[model samples]
Target: MRTAYSVETVRAAERELIARLPEGALMQRAAAGLAAVCAGLLRKVYGARVVLLVGPGDNGGDALYAGARLARRGAGVTAVAMDPERIHEGGLRALLAAGGRLADGVPARADLVLDGLVGIGGRGGLRPAAAALVERIPAGAVVVAVDLPSGVDADTGEVAGAAVRADVTVTFGAYKPGLLIDPGASRAGAVRLVDIGLSLPEPEVEALQDAEVGALLPVPTASSDKYRRGVVGVVAGSAQYPGAAVLAVSGALRGGAGAVRYVGPAVDAVLARYPETLIGRGRVQAWVIGPGLGTGRAAEVAEVLADPVPVLVDADGLRGLDPAVLRGRPAPTLLTPHAGEAAALLGVSREEVEAARLTSVRALAAKYGAVALLKGSTTLVSAAGGPVRVNPTGTPWLATAGSGDVLSGLTGSLLAAGLDAVDAASVGAYLHGLAARRAASGAPLLAQHIAESLPEAWRQHP
Candidate 1:
């Protein structure tokens, strides 16, 4: 698992480590790692032009010291301080001694640019001076951000205003929530972790790696029959959008469920696509509701909610959800909603949900007393109280119309197969994303293509 700690936890760990080390030893260690990454990016350090956007804090110091290392390697390094008087004294001295000169403004051209204007402590967005420097970065330069991309909230991944769009981000010690979640994640091209030996605590956010996903996958053994493996009940689609039922069932069939029992108005459409589906609702380990289920189906949604089995709610089913009803449920409930649906449920604007994904997802989970999965460029799964799981695998091709319908079914199947709401949602997202990557292969893919590729995705992981 790739873990990310909050600013508070990281700072506490840094302070403790700094107390145990020499006055400037910790900063030097961070600078060394930062410089190594910079050097690697610029294969030949000699004669390369490096510009450092220096600020007043330790973040600027890390860049300054790293710039000194590059200067010593025969590279021309220039430091542009946001506040000349507030720059790190020791770092500035080191840079000057190593043949690096301080510049009043950004130069016309550069091979690389290091953003050291803000660190994990930063919130809201970049200051006017910092934003100005970021805007002046020379085109075509490989922008490498120190610690994290400036202007991104380290804890929430919220970008309030202008933020540095880096080609790569060299983070220290541990990852930050902002680096793994979007829109901060989109700004951060690729991330590289640099260990500074800060013994940290439990992370605030986590992304499951391939091995973790594989271990969580459920595989059938010899004594297992159709019922032993578990059955998934899908209630999706309507006369208006029968394709939704077909796509949902397609995903469920590939999701390790022994059998799928579907119930909805689009039964004929589902049978046409997947004749193996059980026609009516029966005993099921889990239920998947909504997804192309047009409006005015609240009673049907309530019926499923009353069942004593795990339920995954998406699309129209997410509409008008009663928090009290969900909270009183005996079995686990998973709510999957896109920004617009989430906004409607929370009574907030879609922009608000997108801008503050972490806060919105968490609020949804807490408010309903159920696990919540916020679908977007960066899919997030969060429960009432635990580290939020950030899905790492996905391509832009997944933004299709019925993509979410497929996801709802896949997750519901996992829930039926006995995975907890969180695990099912996470694993379902992982496979769904990988499947999309395989099916799309750089081209447009249909919702069914994603469903078709799930088996291949599952095989690769195993």
Candidate 2:
């Protein structure tokens, strides 16, 4: 798993490592890794013009040292000091010794700009001087940030104000939450971590790796029969939007469920698409409700919820959810909701739900005594106990409509296949993102295309 730490956690780890190392050794390691990457970025390192946006802290120090390395390699490097008083004295001296020059503004058409304006310690947006320098950089110039971009919140992934939008970001130690989540993630064009020998604790957040997913996936053995493999029952779709049934069933079929028993008014439509699906729902290992089911379709949902099977709820099923309904339930329940739907349940605005996604999802799960999957760019899966799972594999292309419906089906299928609520949601999200990436492959793709690519994604796993 690719784990991400909060700014505080990373800083603590950095402090521990730095304390053990020789004075400036850790920074040198960071600089060396950064300089190598900068050299590889340019078409030709020899005589390429490079601009460094230098601030006051160690972040600026890293860039200056990197610039000195580039200068020695025949690159014309210039440093635009945002904080003249606080500049790294040792780094500046080293750069000057290596023939790197100091410039007031943007060099005449530089090949690349290194953003050393701020690091994880920065609180708000960039200062006016730093922001001005960032704005002065010409379009298409490859901007590389040291540690993190200037204006992004390292802990919460919130952009305080005007932030440096980098083409690439070279972060030190382990991954920061800002680099993996949105707003901040949008600013960090592409992220590369430079390990500085920090042994992090169990990460505050984690992104599932392919190997993790492969291991988590339900692979039936020779002794496993259809009944033992697991069965998933779906209570979704209404006459109004029967296509939702088709899409959800598509996701369920792609999951490792041995059999799917669908129960809803859209049963005919689902049967039309997936004829192999069991027609009527009797006893199932797991139950998935909502998706296309209208808010008015409470009767059908109540019937399923009465059963002892683990339940995965989504979409309209989120509306009018009585906390009492889930109280003391023998089986597990997973509730998946996008921000808008989550907002409804929380009695708050969608903006509020999104702004504090981690807190909101955890709150909902605890309130209902069920696992909650708050789906978005960084899909959050929180259980009733603790230790939330944050999904990291996703593209903006996955934001296309109908994706959530598919995710609900996939999560339900995983739950049916005998994974717990947390595992089901996390595994489902990982597969959903991988499928979308495979489907898009450099072009726009529809939701149906993403669902169709699940088999290809599974094949890539083992």
Candidate 3:
């Protein structure tokens, strides 16, 4: 699992380590790690044109010390400090001694630009001076940020103002929550964690790695029969939109479910593509309700919720969701909602939910007392009183019709296969996104293509 800590946790860990180490030892360690990453990013360190954008505080000091290291190695390094008088004296002296000079203006073009303008302490947007310099950066110049991209909220992943967009971010000590969630995540192109020995407790957020997901995946043994593997029940699709049934069934078919029992009005539509589907409902371990069941299916929704099985409520089922009913379920309940559906459930605008995705996801989970997967640019799965799961794999091509329906089926199958609510949601989102990326390649792909690519996705497990 890829775990990320909040700014508060990171600071506490840093404080503990700094108190035990010699004066300036911790900063040096961070600077060294930062320099190593910078050196690797540059094709050849020697003669490389490196420009450091310096701000006040320890962030500027890190860049200055790192700049000094590169300058001593025969690279052309310059430090453009936003506040010259406030720069770290030790770091400034080190840079000057190593042949690095303070520049009056930004360089026209450089091999790389180190953004140390803002750190985790920064609140909103970039300062005018820093923003102006960032605007002039050459298009092709590789931008490497120290710790995190300037202007991003380290805790909330919110970009309130103009932020530096980095090609690669060399974060010190631990991963910040901002680095794992969007729109801050989008600004941080690629993240590299540099260990400085800051001991941290449980992370604020986590993204499952392939190895961890592989361990959680259920693979049957010789003793396992079809019934033993697990059976998933899908109740979806309306007469008006029978294709939803086909797409949902397609995803369930690929998921590791032993048998799929579907109950809906689109029986002919589902059977045409998936002949093996058992029509109507029998005993099931879990149920997926509403892909295109649409409105006016209150009784159907009620019937599924009454069953003592892990349930995934999605699409139309999420429209009139009552927290009381969900809390009453004997088994775990998973709620999958796109931004719009989530917004509806919370009685908020879609834009509001999108802007504060982290808060929105957590709120949804707490309110419903269930595992909530908020699907969007970044798929977030949150359980009540727990850190949200950030799905690392996905493509923009996944925003297609019936995509969520496919995800519902896949996740329902996992639930039936004995995964918990959180695991089923996170793992399902990860696989769903990966399959879409594989199916799309570089061009457009239909929702069916994503379903078709699941076996290939499973093959890609590390």
Candidate 4:
């Protein structure tokens, strides 16, 4: 699993390492890693022009020491100190000793820029000088952030003000929550972890690994039969939006469910796309309700939800769900909601949901007595009173329309295939993201194209 540590946890781990090691050891390790990454960013060490946006804290120390390494390697290195007086004395000496230049003004042209303006110790937005430096770096200059970009909240993933945008972010110790979440995550670009000998305990937040996903996937043995595997009944899409049914069914068919049973106005459309699907449901192991089913179609929604099987409620089903009905359900239920829908369910704004994604997903699970998957840049899945699973594999390209519908169907199908709610959500999200990444190849891709890439996603593992 790719585990992320909070700033507090990282500080604690840093402290532990500091106490045991000799002076400057940890910073040297961090600087070495940072310098190595800087070299990789340029793709060559010699004749490269590199600029360091230095601040006062140890963050600036990291950059200065790293710049000294680059300077010795034949890169033209310049340090633009935002806080000259508070800069790391030792680091500054090292840079000057290595023939690195100090410039009061920003460089007119540079191959790469290093953002050392802020680290986990920083709070709120960037100071004016740092912000100005961030703004001055023109396009085409690859920005590499040391620890984190200047104006991002290291703990909450919130960009309180103007933040430095990086092409690649090299973070120390462990992954920070900001690197995994949106807004801050959006600014983080591609993240790389550099271990600084800080041994941390169990992380509070984590992303699932391939082995974890493989273990969680619903795999049936030779002894398994259709009914033995599990049946997934879907109540999705109306005549008005039949595509939801088709897409949902497409994912369900790809998922491990033994059979997919459809019951909705879009039954004809579902049959047309997936002729193998059973048109009318008899018995179902799990139910996936919502998708394109309209908000006012609660009566039909309620009937399917009434079934004593694990249910995944998404899209329109999220609207107007009876709390009493949710409170009384015996079987497991999983609610998949994006920020907007989560906001509606929590009686808060979308910004509120985005601000506290981890808290929001878990709170929604507790409120509804169901597993909740808050879909976004970092899809969070939480079962009430259980460990939250954060999925970090999705591409921005997965933001295409109808993607959520496919995710809901796939998750519900996993549940039908006999995995628990938490497992189903995590596994489905991993597959959905892997498929999108495979399909997109860094280019724009449609939801259907993502759905079509499921086989390649499955083939990635044994």
Better of 2 and 3 by TM-score: 3
Which 10 consecutive positions of candidate 1 have the poorest summed lDDT? 264-273
Q: Each model's TM-score?
A: 0.99, 0.94, 0.98, 0.92
Q: Which candidate leads in lDDT?
A: 1
The residue-by-residue lDDT of candidate 4 on 1-462, one tens digit each, is 887878898999899989999999999999999999989888888999999999989999999999999999999999999978788899989998988988897898999999998888787889888898888885788999999988988876778778898889999989987787777888998999998878887876677888888777777799998888888988899877889988898898888988899888887778777899998868999999899887578787788778888999999999977667887989988999999999999899999898778779878988888889999988988877745778878888999889988898888899999898888998899999999999999999988887799878877766
lDDT of 4 at 175: 90
Ranked by lDDT, the better of candidates 2 and 4 is: 4
Q: List the residue pairs that clash in candidate 1.
A: none
RMSD of each: 0.8, 2.0, 1.2, 2.3
Candidate 1 lDDT by residue in tens digits, 1-462: 999999999999999999999999999999999999999999999999999999999999999999999999999999999999999999999999999999999998999999999988998899999999999999999999999999999998999999999999999999999999999999888999999998987788999999999998889999999899999999999989899999999999888889999998888888888899998979999999999999999999999999999999999998899999999999999999999999998999999999999999999999999999999999999999999999999899999989999999999999988899999999999999999999999999998899999999999878
Q: Is candidate 1 or candidate 3 better by TM-score?
A: 1
Give lDDT tens digits, candidate 2, residues 176-214: 877777768878988998887889888866778888889
Candidate ranking under TM-score, highest first, comes to 1, 3, 2, 4
- After best superposition, candidate 2 residue 14: deviation in angstroms? 1.9
Error of 3 at 368 (Å): 0.6
lDDT of 3 by residue, 303-376 (tens): 99999999999998887889999988889999999989999999999988987899999999999899999999
